[model samples]
Target chain A: MTMNRETLINSILGLALVAVPLIALGMDEPFIITLATKVAIFAMAGVGLNLVLGYGGLVSFGHAAFFGIGGYAAGILASHALNYEPIMTWPFEVEGTTQMIVIWIVALVASALIALAIGAITLRTSGVYFIMITLAFAQMIYYFAISWPAYGGEDGLSIYVRNGFPGLNTLDPISFFALCAVMLGLAMAFSAVLIRSRFGLALQGARQNSQRMTAVGIAPFRIRLVAFVISAMITALAGALYADLNRFVSPTMMSWHMSGEIMVFVILGGVGRLFGPLAGAGLYIILEHLLGSSFEYWQLPLGVLLLIVVLFARGGLVGVLAGERKHA
Target chain B: MFTLFLEQLLNGLQSGVMLFLMASGLTLVFGVMGLINLAHGSLYMVGAFACAAVAAWTGSFWLGLVASLMAAAIAGALVEILIIRRLYNRDHLDQVLATFALILIFSEGTRWIFGSFPLFLSVPEFLTGTVMMPGEFQYPLFRLAIIIAGFVVAVGLFLLIGKTRLGIRIRAGEADRGMIAALGVDIDRLYTIVFALGAALAGLAGAFVGTTQSVQVGMGEPVLILAFVVIVIGGIGSIKGALIGSLLVGFTDTMGRFLLPHAFATFLDPASATAIGSALASMLIYIVMALVLFLRPSGLFGTEA
Candidate 1:
C-alpha cells in the first residue's frame, strides 16, 4: 500500500508508541512502561469516543460511564472471585471469574446495554440538549457508584492480582503494556474500517446533514445509536484494562472530569482524525508527567494550553503534523 | 414526625433556591448567547473565594457578599471578552472544550492563591440564630434568608425581563441576534452584559451558600452539576423553568433521602434499607430528569427545538 503523509505519520506514531515501551523494557524502566500502558488504555477510550464524536457528530459528554463500568466490571468480578462469592444466587447463579477474557466480555456487554438505553433516550435530543442529557445520565451512574456499597462504593474496589491472560505473565509491566498496546492497535484498526464502511458513510452523512440524509432514506437516529453503543463498548474495554493496570476501580473514573479528559484526548489530537486520540493522550500524559514533577499547579498550564488550542489551533497535533484533511 | 418532615421540606426549599440562582444565570446565558458555559461554575467558586477572603479580612458578611458579586461578574465579563466571545459561532463541542479548559484554569489558579484548604464564611451575627415556625419548630435563619433571597431575585428577574428596557433588548437578542444587530443593538456588548449578569447571579449563590457550606476550590462543581439538572428539567433557556425545576430537584433529592430509607425500613432490615434507600435517593433526581425529557425533550418549559 502507498503511504500518504497522514498514513505515514500514523504509522510512525503507532510504532513509536510500541517502541517506547520496548526501549523502557530494555532499560528496565518499569514506570515508563506503565505510563505508556496508561496512554495506550486512555487512547483506546479516546478512539471509542472519536468514532461517535469525530465521525458521527454526537458529542456524548458521558463516555466515562462506559469506561468506569468497564473498570468496575473488572474490579467487581475479581473481588467476587477472590472472595469465593457468587455475584448472583437467584434464578440463575453467576459467579465471578478472575479471567481477563471473562472480564472483557462482561465489560463489553454491560457497557453496550447501558449505552443502548442511554442512547435511546439521549439521542432523541440533538445539539446542546444531547450533550447535557448524556452528562446528566453519566452523573446518575456516578452518584449510584458513590452511594452503592455493594462493591465498596466511593472507596472503590481493588484486584489483588492482575486478571490472568491465557499465555502472558500479566504481572510484568511490559507484558501488560504489550497487551494494552495490542488492544489499542486493534481498536484503531476497527475504527478505521468502521469509518470506511457503508455504514460509516451513512453516519457521517447524517452528521453533516441529517435532514438531507433522511430525504435520502436513512434513519440517522438508528445509525447514531449503533455508533454510540459501539463507541461505548470500545471505551469500556479500555476501562477494564485500566483497572487491571492500576489494580483498582473507583467512582473517580466515572467523574465528569474523567469524561472531560477523555474528550480532551480527542480534541487535543484533532477531532475526526483516526490517530487523534492516541496523539492527544500521549501528549497529555507526557505533559502531566513532565510538568507535574516541576510545577505544583500543572493543571493551570495544561488549561492554558487547551484554551490556546481551542482558540488558535483549530486542528490538534495530528492536524498540525498532517495538515487539513482533504475532503473526498 | 411532622416537624421532621417540615424541616426537611424547608431544607429542600433552601437548596432549591440556591440551585435557582445558579440555573437562572446558566439559562440566561444559553438563551441569549446560545453558548453553554461549563466554566460558569468556576465563576461561582470565584465568588465563594472572594466572599470568604473579604469577610475574613474585614469581618463583615454583607461586605463580602458585595465583593462576591463584583468579583464573579468582573471575572465573567473578562472571560467573555477574552475567550467566550470567539466561541459564539463555533459548535457546542468547541464551547464545551474551551469552557472545560477554563474550569481547569480557574480551579488551578484559585488553588494556587488560596492553598488547598477550605475557607469558612460566618453568617452575620444577627442572622446566626434560628427562627420559630408555626408548630414551635425552629429553622436556621440563614437558610430562610437564602430562600427569601432566591424569591426576591426571581421576582426581580421577572420584572427586569418583563418590564425593563434592557430586558427588551435581551429578549430580542435571544429571539434574533442578527436581526437585533442589524437594527443597531450592539450585539457584542449585549452578549457580554448577559454573560456578566448570569455570572453575578452564580456569584451571589456562591456567596450565600458559602456561609452554610465551606468555601472550597471544588465546591462549585457539584453545585454546577445540580444546577445543570435544574436547567435541563426546567428547559435550557427558561428562567421560570429553572425555578420550577430547581424546586423539584431540591425537594425530590432532600425528601427522597429523608423518606426512602424509612419507606424501605418497613419491609427490609435497617442496614440494607438505609443502604438501598440512600443509593436510590441519590439517583432520584437524574431519574426524574430522564422522565421529564422522555415526556418533554426540550425540558419542562423549554421551547421545542
Candidate 2:
C-alpha cells in the first residue's frame, strides 16, 4: 500500500491520540487525562476485536465475555490478595496477585483460554450463526457473573485501592494514564505486525475464500482459532485496564452493550486500517463529551450519526478522512 | 413428585410458546430477507409499551393487545421502508451496526416518551383463575391461554406459509428473489409485507409476554437473546426448527432453574449451592446449543449452506 492523503491522516491521528493525552497531563487537566485514558483503553479493546472482525472476517457480538473475564481476573485477584485468600487451592494452591504485570498475564491467559473454547464452537458456522453463537457464549458469562455472588453478584466487584504497577504511583491519574497508553501502543504495534505477517495473509485468505485457502494447504479454521484467541487476549488486557481505571468491575462490563461499544469504536475509526481504533475511540469520546454536555438525550443523536455513517460512510471516520476500503 | 414435574413441564410449555411467537417472525425475516435485525427486539418492546399505554388509557386489556399489534406492525413497516430496504445489499457488519443503532434510538426514544420505570399490564379478569387438573395439579388459566394462542398462531402461520398463494410467493422469494421478481410479483412490496408480518409476530409476542412480565424499555433484549438462540438451534430458516428449538430451550431452562438448585442443595451449603446452581442453570441452554452445533453445524432442521 502506497502512502497517500489517507496515510498522512492516519499518522496525524496516531500522533494526536498519544500527544493530546500527554498535553492534557502537562496542562494539569485531570478530566482530560481521565477521558484520554478511557479513549486509549477503548481503542485497545477495538484493536483486539479488529483482528477477527476486520482482518479475519468474523463478526463476534460476544467480545464482552473476554472483556469481562479480563476485568474479573483483576478484581478477583486484587480482592483475594487484599482479603488474604487463595485463588485456587487444590491445584497447587495459587495465591492472589496485586502486581499489574501478573494481573495482566492472568487476564490475558484466562481470556485466551475462554476464547479458544468459544471460538472452537463458533467457528463451525459462519455469518449469522457465528454472530449469534458468540453472543450466546458472552451472555452465558454475563448471566453467570450476575448470579454468582462470590465477588459481588448483581452489584459489581470494587477495588478499594488501585492495584500497583512495579514503580508507578497508580493513585495519580497521569501515571495510570501513562501505563494505559503504553499498553495501548504495544497492542497497536502488535496489530500492525500481525496484519502484515504470513499468518495475517492466511487469515485474510480464509475470509476471502475457504476453498482456495484449503487448496493452498492452510487450514482456515486453525488460523481463525489462533487469531480469535489472540484477539480475545488483547481485548482482555484492555478490560483489565478499564476496570482499574474505574476501580470497579461489574457484569455491565461484559454486557452486550459493552461489546457493541467496542465494535462501534472499530467501525467508527475504519475497519482493518492501522490506527482506526484509536481514531474511532477518540472521536467517540469527543462526541460523548460534546453531545452529552449539550443535550439531555444524546444517545438519540449519536444513533442518528451512527446510522448516517453506516449508510453513507462505508469505510468509517478513518475511511472518510483517509480513504475507502482498498485491497490490502 | 409427578405433579411437581408436571408443573415444570407446563411452565416450560408456556414460555416455549412465547419464544415461538418471537422466533417465528425472526426466522421468517432472516430466512427470506437474509437480514439479521438487532432491532427486532425493539419492535417487541414497542408492542409491549404501546399495549401498556393504550390499555391504561382504554382500561381494557383486549384493546391494549390490539393496539400493541397495530403499533408494532406499523413500526416494522416504516422501519423496513425507511432503513432496512437500503441495507439489503450491504455486508452483515453494516446490517448489524445499523440495526444496533436502531436499538439505541428505539430504546432512548421509548425512554423519552415513557419514564425509566416499568409499566404493569394485568391479565384480563376472565383468564385470571387457575384450572384444577385430575389430581391436585392446578394450572394458571392465563398461561394455558397463552399456550393455546401460541399454538393457534403456529397452525395459522403454517397454513399461511404453506396453503396460500402468498406463502408460495414467500417460499419462492426465499428460494430465489430474482426469479420471483422476474415472474412479476412486485418483490419490493412483498419484501415490505414479509418484514411487517415478522414484526407483527414479534409485537404479538411482546404483548402476550407483557401481560406476565412488566413492560419496560430493555425487556425485549433478553427475550431477543433467547429467540436468537432458538433460531440458531432450530436452524435459521426453518419454522419447524423454530418450534422444536423453542420447546427444547424453554424446557431445558425451566427444568434447570427448578431442579438444579435442589440437586446442588443436597451436597453443598445453600448459599454456594444456590449461586453455583443458578449460574450453571442459566448457562444450560447455551451448553445445549454448543452440543447441538457440535453434532450438526447447521441446526437439526437447517439446510447445510
Candidate 3:
C-alpha cells in the first residue's frame, strides 16, 4: 500500500525476476529462460494458493486438484485438436482448440468448477479436516486420471506441437517466458486488487476470528468458499501455462507433491505477501538447479533448509529480507 | 460367483484390517495430542525398511517385526521431542508444513540409506500356506494373520484407552490440555509415550504389509493418503470412527474394483467398461467419504471435527 523500504525491495525483486529472463534472452541462454519460466509459473501457483492459505486462513491442501485439472484441460484440448476430434460428442459436438487464449479460458472454467464443488464440500470443515479432505479429493482426481484410458491415462498426453498465441512465436523459449511473466504480473496485480477489496478484508477478518466476523454480519464460510474458488482458478490457470511450457501434461502435475511444492513456494516467499511467492519461487528454482547439479539427494538439504525456516525464520526469505511490508 | 465374491470380501477385510492398524495410530495421536504428523507415513516406511533389513540379516520374521516396532517407536519419540512438541501450539498449516518437511527429510534420508530400489520382505515359511475358509474359499495365511493381528491391536488399544491410567490422562489431556498440565501430569513424557505407541502400531502395519508389497521409498504415501481418508471419514480423533471407516472404505474400494467392470460390462463394451469401471472404482472411497461427511460432518463416531 505504501512505498516503504520493504515495498521498494518487493518491487525490485519482482523487476529482477522479469529482467533476468530478458537478460538471458538477450544473451541467448535458453536454459535460463526455461528456468525463469518455471519460476514464474510456480510463483503464480503460489500466488493463487496464498489467496486462501495466507489471506483467507483456509488451508486447502487439494489445490493440486485444480492445478492438475488445468493441465489436463490444456492437454486434452490440444490432444483432441491434434486428432481432429470433438472433445465432447454428446448432444452437441465441441471441437478442441489449440489457441492459448481459448485454452486459458477452458482451463480456468474447468478448474473453477472443480474448485467450487470441492470448496462447497470441504469448506464445511475447517482446520485439519479441510487440509486432509482437499488432499483426498486431489488423490481421487489423480487416480481417476490414471485409470481413465480415454486421454492417455497414466502415460500422460502431449501436444504434437506447442499451442500458439495470437502474434508471438510460442515455440521460442524467450517468447514463452515473456508470456508467463505477463501472466504472473497480471495475476499479482489481480491479487493485490482483490486484497484491497471489501471481500478480501472480510476474508482476512474471517481468518482471524470467524465468529467475530459472523457477529459483525459477515459470513466467513461464504468468504472462504469464494476465496478458495478464486485461488483454485488462479492455480489452474498457472497449471495450463505450465503444461504449455513443458508441451506435456501428466497426473504428476496434479499429485500431492505439486500441492506441497506450491505451499512451500508461498511459505518460503512469505505467506500473505504479494511478492512472497515470486521471491520464494525464485529462490527455490535457483537452489534446486544449483543443488540438483551437485547432489542427487538435494531434497534432503532442501528439507533441512525448510525446517530451519519454519523453526527459526518464521517470516521466510522475503519476510526476513523485507521487514513486514503491508502489501505488494 | 459366490466363491469369487467371498474371496474378494476376504481381501477387502484383510486390507481393511491393515487400514485399521494405520488409522488407529493417526486417530490416537490426533485425539490425544492434537498434532497432525504427515510424517506418519515415513514412520511406516521406516518400519518396513527396518523389518526388511532385519529379516534379511537375522532370517527371522519375528525379530524383524520387533525391530520394526522398536525403530518406529524410537523415531516417533525423537520426532516428538525434536519437532512435534513445538508444533502442538502452532496452527494446523504450520504443523502440516513442518511434518511435510519431515516427510521430505525422512524419505530422502531413507533413500540415501536404502537406495531407491524396492526391497522385498518374504512371508515367513510357516505362514506361507493358504487356509480354508468356511464354504471352501482359500485365503493366504499371512493375510489372515494380519487381520488377526489387527484385531489384537484393536482390542489392546480399546483396553488401554478404556481402562488404563495412561488412557485416563490422555482423555483428560484431550478434554483440556491446560487442565491436565495444571494437574501436574508429566505432559511431555505422556506425549512422547503416546506418540511412540502410535508409531509402533504404524510400524507393525508396515511390516505386515511389506511382505505382500515391496518395501519401496514412497510406498507409505499412497497408504498414508488412504489412512488419512479413513480417519477423515471416521472423524479426526475417534478410534471407533477409524475402525468403522476403514472397514467401510476397504469393502467399498475392494468391491468397487472387483465388481465395477462386471457391472459396466452390462451397459458398455468390455474394454471400455474395464477402463471406466476401474476409473470410477478408484474414486468410490472418496465419494463415500464425501457422502459420509456430508451426512455426518463429524464422522459417524467422531465427537468433533
- Give the best candidate by TM-score: 1
Best by DockQ: 1
The positional error of residue B249 in candidate 2, measured at the CA in angstroms, is 0.7
**Candidate 1's residue-wise lDDT over A1-328, tens digit each?**
2228889989888998999999998999999999999999999999999999999999999999999999999999999999999999999999999999999999999999999999999999989999998998999999999999998999999899999999999999998898999999999999999999999999999999999999999999999999999999999999999999999999999999999999999999989999999999999999999999999999999999999999899889888888888862
iRMSD for every model: 0.6, 0.8, 0.8
Once superposed on the true structure, which residue ranges of model 3 sit more than 4 Å away at CA? Answer: A1-3, A325-328
Compute the DockQ of candidate 1: 0.88
Q: Model 1: how far is B200 from its true place, Å?
A: 0.7
Clashes of each: 0, 0, 0
- Give candidate 2's root-mean-square deviation (CA, Å): 1.3
Which portions of model 2 show Cα errors greater than 4 Å? none
Of the pair 2 and 3, which is ahead by lDDT?
2
Q: How high is the CA lDDT of each candidate model?
A: 0.94, 0.92, 0.90
For candidate 2, lDDT tens digit of each residue in B1-305? 78988989899998998899889999998899899999999999999999999999999999998998899999999999999999988888999999999998999899999989999999999999999966689988998999999999989999999999999999998899999999999989999999999888889899999998899999989999999999999999899999999999999999999899989999999988888899999999999999999899889899884
The sequence of per-residue lDDT tens digits that candidate 1 reaches over residues B131-160 is 999887999998999899989998998899
Per-residue CA lDDT of candidate 2, range A76-181, in tens?
A: 9999999999988996999898888899999998998899999999999999899999999999999989988788998999987889998899989989988998
